[model samples]
Target: MKESSVASTNMAFTDCMTPTELPAEKNGMRMKNWRNRIGLFLKPNLSKHTKNRSHRPSSDDLNQWAQSFDKLLSHKYGKAFFLIFSKSEFCEENIEFWTACEDLKTITSHAKLASKANSMYEEFIRDEAPKEINLDFHTKNAITQSLHDLSASSFLAAQLKVYSLMENNSYPRFIHSDLYRGLCVTSTAEEP
Candidate 1:
């Protein structure tokens, strides 16, 4: 399609999303401050930005409306409803804010959980990667670095996915169990 046609189509689609008609299908998300709050959040935004930014408010109304919609959906549908977005969308819009009920400290704590997972992946690859090899040192390091990146990315993908390792009783659970057991054993042995 032509650029102008695409832009117009986008505008029309956006116009159809009315906050007043939100809270449909008992999705559990509510629009607590459907109008005012969204207005503030999308205050400085323009309509065009929304399509490009992904979950971003193109206008003030969209933000306030989404916040309200989310609240209603959570109340009715529960936590499972919020998993509609992919990880990129969740992170972009800061999904944890409302999911954890706006607790900044808890949000930070969850972030640490994700960060710790990433560090674990990196550390595993680093330790396993060969130090001395037939290739040049730099080349070996580069290959190891790629391996590290792949491991870390996989971990993140698993965590962010709603039905993935986040709740799986397999690899992640085993790793955590092993880690805690190791810590406990180390502390006991060091005691006088």
Candidate 2:
């Protein structure tokens, strides 16, 4: 697959429009800001030696990522690699927004839920959000309405939408990229 494959979200193909009707993008341009890029780059590499460490991900994790998108996101090493790879593709917002939704699910405090809900909206759902994902009018409106009285489920629809976008678009590209293949190679080289 090409490095520049299908777009994760082409806003024109919102809930109201049929997939067939969506226009073929000629330039293949997507909104990507450097703030997200720089933030992701600053994190320490998970594979590097540390004073205190947990399990260093095995080649098996890299192999498993090939099996499914869920497997890639579920494994820490795989997820870290995927995030970096996605960022290179200039669509880091999709994963960042999805990760935020997953984090939101773990919160029990109503105050925190409302706060997180609004923040996710501002960052990923609002019309001019810094990392806005392409969403239809009704879905965006529905989420906005729910924010007044929110819960973990307030962003469920949006989260699922982003998840689907990544799965259908980014995940495949990551699997095909040289970075993923190199990780698998390096992990196996350490064995035997």
Candidate 3:
């Protein structure tokens, strides 16, 4: 089978594995090991439960979706829309990397920043990383250099590059996707 298909299958299987089936070990070693191996590859799907469902876009969101990539990215519904669209394209790693970087910026502790920087680089920047994102040589080299200092801005260059890639490349396709159209129709039908 193709790589994408295998990934999809693994994701499906992993999703179906309930918490009960993967009980925590007395020493936490088993759980830690399991998380290290599987968590890097398969992110839990956020769209499965009703509570986790993407917010239906408002008219303002719809208008902004057509107007600016920045606006679309600012709204949760828009983020969710792009995430679903990126998954279809098998390039969800770009958005995931972008999102991780955004989260990384909130860290105030030097120790936390150091740990997270290493983890992010290993997962998204290293060659053959599980969730390796596409990055130009300059951005990649910048990230490499930033790792030595491990500041909050360590991933900024690569993050911006991935964000621009999604905005320029995936965002257009998402706007044209049937999923986006369906969301528009559903949101429109719900308006009073």
Per-model CA lDDT versus the true structure: 0.31, 0.69, 0.69
Q: What tens digits encode model 3's per-residue C-alpha lDDT throughout 1-192? A: 996676557544332222223336532553344335434223333433345323356656877997898888778867766775565555778788888898899999999888988999999998899988877678888888888878888888788877777776777777876566665665565555
Candidate 1 lDDT (Cα, whole model)? 0.31
lDDT of 2 by residue, 1-192 (tens): 442233324423321222222344511221123224333333344554544323445667777889989998988767777777666565678888889989999999999888888888888898889987877788899999998888888888888988888887778777886566656665565544
Q: Which stretches of candidate 2 lie over 4 Å from their true place?
A: 1-56
Least accurate stretch of 10 residues (summed lDDT) in model 2? 26-35
* Candidate 2 Cα lDDT to native: 0.69
Q: Give the total clashing residue pairs for model 1.
A: 17
lDDT (Cα, 0-100) at 61 in candidate 1:
29
Model 2 per-residue lDDT at 58: 61
Q: How do the residues 10-84 of candidate 1 rate in per-residue lDDT, one tens digit apiece?
A: 434332222223346422243332223233323333443343443331233222323454332334222322322
Rank order (by TM-score, best first): 2, 3, 1
- Model 3: how far residue 126 lies from native, Å: 0.3
Reference-based TM-score of each model:
0.18, 0.73, 0.69
Backbone clashes, each candidate = 17, 0, 0
